[model samples]
Target: MVVGYWRLAGITSGLACAAGALQAQLLVRAALGARHTSTLVHDSIITPFVLRPALAPALAVTAATPLDERWTAQVTLDFSTSTLERHDADGTTTGLGRVSTLAFTVGLRRPLGAGFAAGAGVGGLKYLPAGETGIFRSGAGGVLGLAGAVVSYAPPRVGGRWQLGIEARYDVHRFITPALRSEGFTSARTVHRIALALRAGRGGAAGAAGAAGAAP
Candidate 1:
């Protein structure tokens, strides 16, 4: 587990630095009047669901914010009530109960432009795995401190009105707690999401209305 985390951290740092440097250069050039560009910054929520042959359904939510035209910062909250069921060779059934977690992540989103984007991110998942029956416990030990990356594509908009996007993420974290505490397991979770918004005000507008630092 320690080795896995080390590798993930190293990879995420390398990729984020490389991508951030490149994008910063482009943004600087565009800002210097060398070219025309429109940067987009926005936020949205994530909803995750699971439906399989023998597992109960589950759902999770995530909150994300754009750091730049090609980077974003995010915080995700995961909650689910689906447990794993096992059938013994003697026709006996056992339930593993429900599992839940809350994870916070600091990630970078790289936009490919033309309504497309891709990037990688790394963060830690903080959650209390359930141990007892329908009650929430803080020490069941499910998944703790995980790292992940995401690739996304969205509709390019000129005036920050409405945009549609699709994203996929791979997460490596602890899976089962209690019995095994080997820093969890590496699980890859993918998400598909949509967003909608209306821009009616901004800091610029507020400043203008308040007449701060205005030349008489």
Candidate 2:
């Protein structure tokens, strides 16, 4: 009985210490609109088409913890739903039904003064296809790895613990699949995306009043 009591006490203290060490600030955001450039999927043989995802109307959530006086560590999660579009040589386009994209990234952010901040990070992107068709006949490239970066602007706190801001983000990744490889394509195409959104978060006044970007 004494050993059991000691074990329970150890567990409780461990939980308390973890909770005290990892104080995180949360931010919720929604994309005003988004866009992706057309990239060549396959070239020089068979039916060739360029691929692009109609990006818009997405949402994101971010959690951040201050690492120092000038830097903060953050993780962001975002997702979008759209049609996977294919463009032919003749410039005609076809929609490949409903597709969903989910992404997660870890990054560091620092204030650039005057309500501006810069951040960069790396992440993974997964494509969920509605059906087995088009280039996704085998699967949407198996969770392509990606690199992402962001810039944001947050005004002075509006007399509260939560704050509002705007952010611009960009991501890049290589696109390929077993289906593409089987179709005589040997190389992966580079895909790029850009987005803008409005965000509201718990630590908006981090850097504005010489708070040094620390979460309160």
Candidate 3:
């Protein structure tokens, strides 16, 4: 975990330096939505362990800068938490627990239409057990590689500096725990989410020229 944090810090610092040199337009976006997550565990000597679909609230914050008229570079941070329950062979509930995740991604976005855009990126994810016990109890928390895609729409300028939009995102990653590995198991986690966001920033030719002129 400590090493993971250091890696994230280094990546962030490098991006900050690059942003400064490019004189990229600064844009901040905040979103809120619901997330659905599921995990599939493969184990030797037994059937796979599939967790029930877990649905929870999701939130995200993003910082973006235009690389050109049609492309933008951005970094996003997302979070979600949910309760999961295990089922017995007969489909009866055996135990229940909680899991939470934090993810960071850096990706590129391209305009799809006048008000729509799409993006794809890769980053890192961390999973933590939240008040979880029983068979799912594993103090092991680890970080893994993550990849995601996003589709968003922002209405034309609403007479202000802020623009409102809707976004849908999907993420894929792997989750493995000491407890699972101890039992010889590996898991894959997937998340789907949708959100409404407010974007505040400037871009395009005029914005780029201004930013470049202000660069040191």
Candidate 4:
């Protein structure tokens, strides 16, 4: 009796491992297949879903004017492009499509006493999709107003007129597409984005001379 039970246990464990491997393969296939066809699974309703952007590189240009010793007025133009991913209730994700993002922001920055500065920005965010498929079936969503905050650090004791810096930014906006609304989405989802980037240019500090000014 004991020998027979041991054999049954070994078979069960082996079957479990095989099932896990098969499930992983199917998951991968589903993600790849989503790019080719829309009929991944037909249900009563497409209902609501989540779409997210992958980590992307951002390019930016800025203009600034000193307001006072501690404050500076700044305007920035930024752009990023990456793939949009769809998140489902089953915790599985697929690539919906590629999207390019553009934004124009105006903000004010003030130093934090140790080469760090904090700023708040208000702007408009626009989405440009490569194709009008997936959630962008009707068209790319219109531009939405957004607000963001940034923190930057620059070593004041280095560099010439150009002061190199690092910045971290965070923003939030509501997202909803025409196709998503038509498919039964009632409310827009709040989307949050965060980026960390290296910045080179004016330190944007007021009344601070860089290393070049002090060179004898």
Candidate 5:
């Protein structure tokens, strides 16, 4: 069952990566004659209050570097809660509890110009604090899982020190227990997320001009 889940996740990631590559190629073909530099770099963090089911805070950071005027490679780190207490109808708390998780991602991006961009990426992560109560038990059954994401970005504006973007990612996490254990065991935890982000930096004539001559 674990193997099957892993294979499914791998297929999903592969499809996402292929889509991103195709988009990049299309962008390059569209602007074949333009004189444009192939580099625009920026970083941002997404904070989602509703996304966090528990009292703990959550944040996602992305480091993006353009491969060309319309293509970019991005690395992302996401830290958030995986599970929260199930409250009763009367707002009473249950004793049963679950943990949260953090993930790392790498992907590609393609710009549609006019301050709009989109792309895809594939990544995998090993659940932290793994143990008796962790996502996976200690054994050969435990292993890293795969994930994929599609994202969009808006270019920074002149006289503005901030930028905005959005993303939707699919996460697949597998949980397993040895034959000896019976209480906790599962195939995978799959979910989708929609995120909004903001980024801040020094924005002036120099930065704006640089962005224009380069990738934006």
Candidate 6:
């Protein structure tokens, strides 16, 4: 009787371990996108300058691990190229150049009902000058701080292994522009971006079952 009881307990423990393993989910996504940035420059010489409404192309990859049905831990990598131009008092363009940025962030995500999810993260940013001309010069590239938020929507799966979605994000970063550094100033920039992509892999079984039941 004691041997049989020990065997039953072992089976029960094994089932509990398997159940714990199945509770965690993995998600992977890739996206290609663009962003609009508004940059405010403060320089000792130039005083205050605003670079408004610049568009840039970006690419991103993300992975999320489920903490539970309501929450996830997420990590993302992003790359983009941003161009800015300066104009003289007479309205003639004075400086034009491009800066490339690569960033990584970690944060949390939560589902917001009806195929929507929202998240926020903080990370590091690196800037490199792609080119410079006119009044703008390439400065020494360096690393900086970054923070961002994201909202995404995934449509119901249509008998496919992958789910498709649209995502929008907003980011803020602080850096010293080469041009601004020449004038002894720094800048803070804000970017808004959007993308469409495919999400593959597994999520909580409860979430999958719920999604399946809700699909039309």
Q: Which order, best to worst by lDDT?
A: 2, 3, 4, 6, 5, 1
Model 2: per-residue lDDT, tens digit, 37-87?
Answer: 356364643766667776656677777766666777778887877887777
Looking at model 3, residue 88 earns an lDDT score of 49
Screening candidate 3 with a backbone cut-off below 3 angstroms (N, C-alpha, C), the clashing residue pairs are none
Q: Which 10 consecutive positions of candidate 5 have the poorest summed lDDT? A: 29-38
| Model 4, span 1-216: residue lDDT tens | 999999999999999998765432220000000111112122233665555676677776666555545565667777777777766767787887788878788887677756777888899988888999877889867988889887777676555545666777777777778887888867776677777777666432222322112110
For model 1 the local lDDT of residue 190 reads 29
Point out where model 4 deviates above 4 Å: 1-49, 88-92, 203-216
**Residue 47 CA error for candidate 1 (Å)?**
36
Q: What digit string (tens of lDDT, one per residue) describes model 1 on residues 16-107?
A: 99876544332100000011111111112253222111322223233344443345444543333344344444455555454444455555
lDDT of 3 by residue, 19-122 (tens): 77555466667777787665534232364445543677778888777776667778999987777666545556643677677889999887776667788999
Candidate 6 on 1-216: residue-level lDDT in tens? Answer: 999999999999999988776553455667667766654442233543444325677788787766655677779998877666553444555335676678899998887778777889999877655655422366534667788988877766643555556678777865455665666554434443343333333443446435332110
Which is the better candidate, 2 or 3, if ranked by lDDT? 2
lDDT, model 3, position 156: 62
**TM-score of every model?**
0.44, 0.79, 0.70, 0.69, 0.50, 0.67
Q: List the residue pairs that clash in candidate 1.
A: 70-109, 174-184, 174-185, 175-185
lDDT score of residue 128 within candidate 6 = 56
lDDT, candidate 5, 1-216, per-residue tens: 999999999999999998765443321100001011111111123521111133433455666544544455667666654343333444564423444456677877665566555556666554343234421344424444656554444455542433433334444544333522443333433434333334322221333224322222
lDDT of each: 0.37, 0.71, 0.65, 0.63, 0.43, 0.63
Q: Which pairs clash (backbone N, Cα, C closer than 3 Å) in model 6?
A: none
Instruction: Indicate the residue-level lDDT of 202 in model 4.
Output: 44
User: For model 3, what is the C-alpha lDDT against the true structure?
Assistant: 0.65
- Superposition error at 164 for model 4 (Å): 0.8
